[model samples]
Target: MNIIEVEDLTTTYNGHTAIKNISFKIEKGEYVCLIGENGSGKSTLIKTIVGINKKDSGKIIKNIPPEKISYLAQNNMIDLNFPATGKEIIMTGVQKHKCLPFYKKEDYKKFADVCKLLNIEDIINKQISDLSGGQRQRIMLARALIRKPDLLILDEPCSGLDVNITKELYNILNKLNKEDGLTIIMATHDLEEIKTIGVRVICLATTVKFDGDIKDWKGEM
Candidate 1:
């Protein structure tokens, strides 16, 4: 089933239209990539869909509830210097659920499972300020995963990582999509990254320039 549908969507930033007349659909359990040149609204489109940016026109249909959607914003948007341990940072994701003052046993289990999946159990106790670049990225990803989301959305997830770290992050995402059946939508500027792992490519330039199998994409963006 289509878990997300965008029909003629238009959105703006600072009173300027960033995306116009955009449309697309994402099936459940699909791994979709959004690719585009700089200033082409790739980030705008993703943010609009997730409500970080508001749409001025058109429709965004989500088959799943809002709480089931988890978004990982850009690395610059995160402040690793925040005075919190990785575990403390991650458990905040659980706060959006029931608004309780305390976490349940299941919440702690979710944390453990996500850490294991990301191979980040060793760093969960460290202060975010002390983690390496790769470790920080994994911790943030763990934060997203601990939410137990059905759909994970990310914006340029590999922005500041080194080559090996990028590959490791890709491997983790592949496992999540293939082995765990989580739906994913990621915005990126790398073409090889799209071809190597993404199943579907949605190329955007204000609107969708192409939307199809990743193999069918011809390095358009």
Candidate 2:
């Protein structure tokens, strides 16, 4: 089933055009990668789809409800020294759901299960600042999954991680996509590296350039 559909989408910032006349559809259980240079509208497109940025003129139809989508913005933009526990952060994802003034026992169990799935139980009690880079990433991912979202969207997820940590993150995301049938849409600059992981590649540069299988992608910005 198609989870998202965009038609002639356009986005702008400060009256400057960012994305121009782009269109695409994302199906359930698809692993899609948006690749481009620094100012290539990749972020704009994602922000538009996620409603962080409003479209100037276009149509964006989401088959699933807004609450069914979970987004992980760039880590660099997030304050890591918030003095919150990993478990605390994960529980925040459930705030959108119907719950009492405090989390119920079932809520705690769900969060614990998500942490276990991400192999982050060890760091659940640690301060967010005390965790290592990879561990922190896993914790963030656990938070995203705690809500049991149908679609997961990440922006520049591998920006500052080491090679080993990046590989581990890829493995975890692959498991989520293949084993659990989760839909993933990630924006990254490392196209050549993510080609093997993504089923479809969307290259953007102020407009949609390529939208097809990774094997058929031609080299260009």
Every candidate's lDDT: 0.86, 0.86
Model 2 CA lDDT for position 68: 84
Question: Where does the lowest 10-residue lDDT sum fall in candidate 2?
Answer: 190-199
Give per-residue lDDT, candidate 1, residue 120.
86
**Global fold similarity of model 2 (TM-score):** 0.94
Model 1 lDDT tens row, 41-111: 98999899898888899999999988888988776677767889999888988878576668899999998
**Per-residue accuracy of model 2 over 1-221 as CA lDDT, tens digit each:** 99999999989977799999999999999999998888999888889889899999999999998778998877666688889988878888888966666988988888878987878878899998998777888888888888888999999887888888888888888889999999999998766567767578998889888889988998776
TM-score for candidate 1, please give it.
0.95
**By summed lDDT, which 10 consecutive residues of candidate 1 come out lowest?**
189-198
**Candidate 2 lDDT (Cα, 0 to 1):** 0.86
